[model samples]
Structures are given as C-alpha cells and as structure tokens.
Target: MVQPVSTLNHPTLLESPQEWDLSTLYQGFDDPQLTGDLEQLQQTAIQFRDTFRDNIKDLTAEQIADCLKQLEAIAQQSGILYAFPALIFSADTRNTEAKQMQDKVLEALTSIENQLLFFDLELKNLDDARYAELEQSAVLQSYRHYFYNLSKFRPYKLSEAVEQTRNQDSLTGRQAFINLRSVHLGEQEYEPVSTPDGKSCSTEAELGALLFHPNAEVRYNAYGSVRSVMQQHNSLYGYILNSVAQDHKLENQMRGYDSTLHKQLLADEVSEPVFRAIMSGTRDRFDLWQRYYTLKGQALGQTIRTCDVYAPWDSQPVEPLPYKAGVETLLAAIADFDVNYARRAEEFFLKNWVDAKVRPGKRGGAFCWYIHGKHSCLLLSYTEDYNSLFTLAHEMGHGLHFAWISDRQSYFNSNPPMILAEIASTFNELLLLDYLLKQAGDNPALKKTLITRQLEDQLNLLFRQSTISRLELAMHDRATQGTFDHTFVNDQWMSLYHELCGDAVEVLPDHQYDWARIGHIYFKPYYCYQYTASNIVSLACYQKYLQVGKDFIPGYLELLSAGGSMDQVTALKQYVDVDLEDPATISAALKYVEGLLDQLQATL
Candidate 1:
C-alpha cells in the first residue's frame, strides 16, 4: 500500500547527491567566480535602470541590445540559484532549509524584477523605423526570438501606469487566492484507509496504491476513504472555488480575454479549434474505454466502480524490480527511439541528475527542471514499481529534451510552454511500452495485460484529462459570468466525468467534489488538456518513427533541440506530419485503443 504523504520525510529516504556535478552551470552557487559575476550583474542592472529608465528612447540599437544581454545574464543567475534546492524541496516538502532558500531567492528575484521593469517598456517605445533597424542591428539580431515574443504582446500591453498597477495587484489578486488555496488544500486530512492485509494506509498514498491494486475491495475501500474526506471539506472548498472564480471573472474581463478558453489557447500559441478537436475526438472514444473496463470488470468478477478502474489485470503481487535493472530497462527502451536519447538519459542518471529517494517534508509528484544555464534536476518517488519506472523514463525524457535545448539556445529563449512540455516525457513512455511489449513476445496473458495497462495510460492522459479541461473551462466561464458557486462546480464536474467514464463504471455521489483536490485547477485553469494534446502527438510521432526506422531519429532529435526557439506546432510537424486540428489524428489513437480491447475480448 502507498504510505502517507508525510512519510516522504522518513529517515529511510534516499540520500541526495551533495554536488550533483553541476559544473555545466557554475562550479558552485557560492563559487568566487559566480559570486563575482552575480554581483557585477546586480550592479549593472542598477546602473542601467538609473541611466536609461528615463531616457531609453534616445539609446542606440547597440546600447539596447547590450543592456538586454546583461539583464538575461542576471536572470540566468537567479534561476540557477533557485533550481537545485527548489527541486529538492519538491522531492520532499519537509525540508526546512531548502524551502527557506527558495523563499530567499524568490525575494531576491522580486527585487531584480522591480529593477528591470522599465526595460521592456522603454524598448517598445522606439519608432517603427528605429525598431526595424534595431531588428537587423548586429547586437540585436542575436535576440530576434526574444524581440519577436515581446512584439506579440504589444497589443495586450497596457500603458506604463496601468501595467505597473496590474503587476503590483498580481500579488494580491487571483494568483494570491490560488496560493492561499494550496496551503489549506495541501493540508486537508483524509481518513486512513485499510490495505488488503488490514493495515492502515495514508489517504494520499492509499489512493495511489489502490489504483494499481489487484484486489477490488482494497481499491473500493481506499476510494471510499478519499471521498469521505473530500465530502467533509466540501463547504470549505466551495468558498475557495467561489472566491477564485470571482477573481478570474474580474481579471479576465479587465484584460479583455474573449473567453476562458482564449486565455489558455493564447498562452499555448494554439487556437480554440485545435483544443476543441482534441477534446471532441478523445471524448468520442469513451466507448472503447468502456468496453475495456467491461472486460476488466468481468475478469475481476466485480461490479466496476471508480476505484475498480485501476485494478491490476493479474491478481498476483508484482515483485519489486531492482533499481539498476529498472534503469537499464528504461534506457534500453528509450534507445529504440534514438540511441543518443538513451545515452543522454544514462548520463543524467550516472551524473546524479535524479533525486529519487523519498524524504521528510518532501513534496509528492514528479518533475524535471532545467536550472537556468546549468543542468537539469529531476525529483520523484521511486518505489521500483512499473509506474515508477515509467515516471523515471518520463522525467528523464524531460531532462534530455532540456539538455538538448540548453546546448542550442540562449538563456532567454530556452523555455517551452507547459502545453508542449509533456510531449517529450510521453514520447519516452511510448518507447518504453514498445520495448516492454517486444520483450513480452510470446507471453500472451502478460502481453495482453501490458497492452491493457497502456490503454489505461492513454485513457487517463487523453480522455480523462480532456474531461478535466472541459470542467475547468465550464467553471471559469461561469465564474467569469459571476454565476458559479459550489453547487455549480460540483454538478459540472460530475457531468463531465460521466461523459468520460460512460455507463460502465459508477461514480459515487461524493466524487463530484473531486475537482477541489486537483491542484492544477487552482494553478493553471484548463491546463489539463495539454496531457491529451501531448499524448496524441507522442503516439503519432512514435508511430512514424517506428514505420521509418533509423532515418526519422535525426528529425526527432532536431525537434527536441529546437525548444521554444521554434513554435511548438512547427517543431511537431518537423518530426510528425499530423495536424492537431485534424480529428483523424486522435481518432487514429482511439482506434488503436479499440483494437487492443478487441484483442483482450478475443483472448477471453
């Protein structure tokens, strides 16, 4: 059974690498050279603000470019300082010192932000002819991508006074309420759930474990415990939802965003039609998922409920895999896609790029962070399960992608949008699945089960997340219209969820409150659709690579390295020719899933 979230800090947690060998960034955060560089940048920022904030219009293109370069350097240093321990804290929320370090760096960053608030404002003021000339200027040419991004936001840019007002208000506005929600939501207590052996389990941990449990009762009881806790706190969650929705309403209207979906689409550099295509195509695949669940319920001899959705195909407990074998297996699987991808992942593992151990006060979940100009840091809880192996491969994919980009782009242009961020990781998962399936060769039952599980993975990443995105959009729209309250959110959530699960599994009444526990809803509204988008793209690309053999691997590498320097859709097209707006792409994925379900039924 999964342990309590708090147990992440147990003394038995893995020891993190002390150095993590980040010579690629700076020798150390406190190294004399880096310290000297940081101090110089800080002073330069001060000088630039003092010298040019009031008279930047008269500056030459060379002067503006030189100042921007200095600002980029300073921002890079701050990001490097923030990445390591921030990652450590994410791996274990209980780490007091790491948390403190994050706070200190955040405060320092705010100071730096205030110092350079005038840079963009002043740069935008240049006359059209001068701006065009600057675009071709030798110094400014290096920053073409950055300059283009700024130009895109020109229409959305407010007057300097109004911009400053919104910037300050941001701290106490919708963002603040979201942060406030995290504190209370993260600490909410669910009742202890009982494992198959009748041992008490942590609510958070139990839910995770139950999802993979072979025993139907275990999954049911665990889910019951989770729902009980959520229902108990329903009223409190309602108030937070109302407050945040009202805040979004006020701000979205003030900012002139056409609709709730428009904000996310704009941020993702895509359009509503693209997102709608994904959602609609995936939603239409619910019958395939339902058929699979029907077979699953029949195999288990139980009435399939929400909890039963995660029961393992085999009733036997999976033996724990050794760490080295797990790592080797994943690397080999990824190698099938591109040898260099596997090698890069191996380098990170060997170089202590991963913080895999669970520790006290460490946070739950997994992530990969590209620490400025230095190196990537990965944080995850490794239990040696198949799930953990997939997670390791996923995050390693993120690291390898970032490594490629860091080798290619300047600090200012290396960031990819969150919508496209999952593509690399999910791509790794598909490769791993291919590897595992190949090894399972003649073991029919095992092969079938593996395929079934992969189908479940697709369902969650695509179909289920689409449900979340729709719910988020509905909530945001209603809230913006000042019509959303607790009841409204609960009802909308249930309706959307039912559409995904179909008639095969029963969702308990209390399950409607499940949205309250989803932190992503609080962090980035309508962001969950990215999982669906990325999975569809990953599958489409993996299919092409498999078809074309080694020739396509080079193109795949180019896509990874291109990063944000190119538009996400363009990079995706460079590797795979599918258009996201074409419903056929997602329909192809669903058809594949339906074929798997048919195979399972035929075997039965």
Candidate 2:
C-alpha cells in the first residue's frame, strides 16, 4: 500500500546524494531545467509526429535510422524525468510537492506516448521493400528486436478512429475503474483488535507486529482483525472486482486477444510452457511446506493456523541488527562473490543512496530507483531485525544491478523487462544465505532456521505466487467471456488457494477473501510468475557458484551488466546454462526444498 500524501514530515529518504549525482534528472523537481525538459519533450514529440507520422510508410534507410535514434533519446529523458519524482514520492507519499510533480510529469508523458502510438502502426503498414530497405540500415538492424516488437502488435491495431477511442478509453476505461477501486480500497480502514498485551494497533500495524510476535494469541487476534475489517466492506470489494473484470473484457474483445493471458504473456516475451513448468514443479513440492507447518505446529505445541504461518519459528533469541551492521553485513556477503559487487554496494551505503529510517507517513517495503547511469536511491524502513537486513541486501542488489546495466548499455537499452527484474535481487539473497550458513558453522538450530527461511522464500515465489498467477489467468479468461460476478470470482480464488496450500495447514474459513488484500492482482495481473521463474534461475545459478567457486563470478557479473540489451532468456543463459522450457530447472528447485525438509525433520 502507498503512504498517503499527507504523512511526510521529514527529509530522510529524499536527501541529496553525497557521491553520485541525480541532477541529470533535474537539480531537483523545482529545477527550471526540469520544466524545460518537459516543454522540449512535448515539442520534440510534435516535431516527430509532423516529420515522420505519414513518412514512416515510405521511409528510406537513413530516415528510419534518424527516427529511431530520436525516439530513443526522447524515451530516455522522459524516463529520467518520471523516475526522479516517482521514486521520491514512493519513499514519502505524504510529500504533496513530490506527488504533484509525479502527476504532472505522468500526464505530460502520457500525451507524448500517445503521439508515438501511430509510429508503430504506420511502420508496420510499409511495403515489404520499404521495410526491407529500413532493416538493411545498420541502425535499424541493431534495433531489430525493437522493430519486430512493434510489428507483433499489428494484429491488435485498430483503425485510426478506433485507436483514438482506445487512447481515451485507456485512461477512463479499465484504468479509471482500477484507479477508482484503488482510492476506495486503500482508504477503507481495517480495525486492529485488542492484543493479549491489551495494546491497540491499526490494521496494518497489527499485521506487521503479529508476524514477529512471540505470542500465539497476538497472531490470532491480528488474523481476526483482518477478517473483521474485510467483512465490513465485502460488497464494495465485490463491486470493484466486477467492474474491473468487465473493463478488462471490454478491452480484450476490442483488441482481439486470443486468450486472457495472451496479452500479458506477449508483453513478457515468454511462453506458456515455461510458466506451467514453474507452477507444476512448485505444486509438486507442496509437502515441503506441509512438513514445515507440521514442524512449526510441534514447536508451537498446537495446530498451525493461517495467522501463525507468518511468525518466526519458535521465536529465536537473535539480536536486533543495527542499520550500519546490516549494511556492512550485506557488503561482506557480496564481497565473497567479487570485489566489484562489494565496492559498488559500499559506495551506495556511504553516499546518501539509501533512505533507511522509518518515520510517520513514510511508505513501507523497499525499492531501488535508478535516476541515471551514475546514481540510484533505496527506500526502506530499517527495522532492527534479521528480515530487514535481508531487505536491505535485496534492494542493494537492485541498485547495483541498475548501475551495472546502465554503465554497459546505451540509455535506451537500460530498461530490462519486468520478468528479469527480480534476478539480481534474489541472487543477492542467495549470496546472503550462503554467507550466513558458513558463519553458522556447527550451530544446528540457527542453520535449520535459515534453511527454513530459504524454503519459505521458495514457498512464496514458486508455490504461492505462481498459483496466484494461474488463478489470475482463470479469472481474466472467464471475464473475457462475459463472466463477471463477485461470488464466482471469490469462489475461484478460494479454490486456487486450496490447490496451492494443499493440506500444508488448516486454512481458516474467514481466509476465503485472501485475494482481496493482494494489491498486485488489481495492479499487475499475472505478474507473480516472474518471482517463481526468477527463483528457479537463482537457485540454479547459486548452486553453480557453490560448486565452481571463483570461476562463476565473471559470468554472474556479466549477467547483471547484460540488462535489457538482450532477451531475458539469452541474458540468463550467459551465466546459467538451463533451458527455461525444460522441467529440469523447476525440478532442481523442488529437490532443494525436499532436501531442506529432510534437514528440518532431523532437527525436529
């Protein structure tokens, strides 16, 4: 959930960089240069429309190259402009100035994007000879993927008049429904029940506190609060679901998508076989989690419930990790792989590159935003806990990944697809686990807990999230065929939960509306598959690093720096030689989970 725009009261996350510069985006949002860039981008988009909108169908080789280069430049600067304020606002959503800047830039950028929508349609309309001539050009040849990508959308293209209607509908059609739903859902208050300690909390705070609480009763209270609150507005949620699903149906029919998942998969540039492999392999390992809950239930001296699933196992007496120690620990872990990884991380830490403190009105979760080639900023609430340490390491991985890629590629080529975005960050967590395990040495209990945590990561990415993606596919498929109802969607969602959970533990009756709290469903449909896919790839690469020692660092570094210039599969193949289509990668991850189950059983 986003922090409200009225909550910010300080400058912890938005402070200026001490090492790298972000002035490339603008000296600040208030910078005159920022306004100049906006005006310039608008002018350039108009000039581009005037110069090539009609000429694309008859473009000579040189003219095609010029247009492509200009388009790339426009996109790169536009990204910087949006990136700066969006990142700033994400960290401190209460900053009205930042939010206003974000909205202003987004509105301006949307207009620019709309202006260029015709370029692709027009380019695809060219004769074979004209396209052939353009393709033969060196510049166009280099961007073959980009050109082919635009051509792939020719099937979805409507007539100019219909396209214009879609342009308007895109803002107010499904998107508007989604935005309206967001405003309603985010504002709906969930009451926090009285805890065993007799302390009161807000709904989200109680959930956060429950996950780490030593007492079982607190977890149950948190769960009850969640149910009670969600129940209050169940009908509103149902209405939102129906409206959004109908919106999607309207758009899908207009665009002529073969399947509901087809549009999302096409954008990802991956295949259904690969997605199914991850889902199936993860489902097969459901017993690993069943075993885990069995162990957890034994430790807790009772049956494990939905609320208990999140709390720490047996509440180990680990010390709180201070912010500096967390940063240093992460650096030491990265240092084991390569000096470059460690040095880059240290540079980020020493500079004002991270907003690590928690304050009122600040957003939750951690993210890394790359402002340009030279700089990035991390937003996180640095709680003094083991999980928070891992969070820091995870976001740092993203920051350094951005840096590595931006340095290696042209500005236009630096944006990786969302499917590959999780790789570098997950890789860091793998490295951190390796570092922690080695340090644990003969400490069986600590090692067991770490292994369990690792298995939990698998449970989340592969089993839980992958299952959610499948459910999303089903929901959207039904909606496309005119199936839009609250009860039907809720029933389907609950059925999916049963399949994924698979007797791991007894699911509470009230948990049927679990999908309601999952914001990703409303924002990015079928987006969870990437987490599962990346986990499969990360485990494979991490295992290789363990076996081959220093020999793997060069390949790993190359993978991080490869970025968006190449396809995700091609970039992954450079470091880890596994066919994503093959079931082997998923099987390997499941087998690793199976091994952990054995270790956990022995500890018990």
lDDT tens digits by residue: candidate 2, 1-604: 0111111122232332222245545688778989998999999999898877776766666777777788878888888889888766655556778767876887788788878877777877777677666756786666666665666676787776677667667565666665555445434455665656586766353355455566777777777776665666666666676677676667678889776577777777678777677777777777777777778788777777777776677565455556555565677778777766777777775556777766444554567877654577887776566677777778888888888887776665676766667778888998888788877778776676677778777777777888778778778877766656656766787787776566666677777766766666776667788878877887888888888889887887788777666677877776666456668878888888788778777777
Model 1 compared with the native: what TM-score?
0.88
Candidate 2: Cα lDDT at 540: 84
lDDT tens digits, residue span 215-259, model 1: 777777777776777777777777777776676676567767776
Worst 10 residues of 2 by lDDT: 1-10
The regions of model 2 sitting more than 4 angstroms off are 1-29, 94-97, 181-206, 226-228, 359-361, 372-374, 441-443, 483-486
Error of model 2, residue 283, in angstroms: 2.6
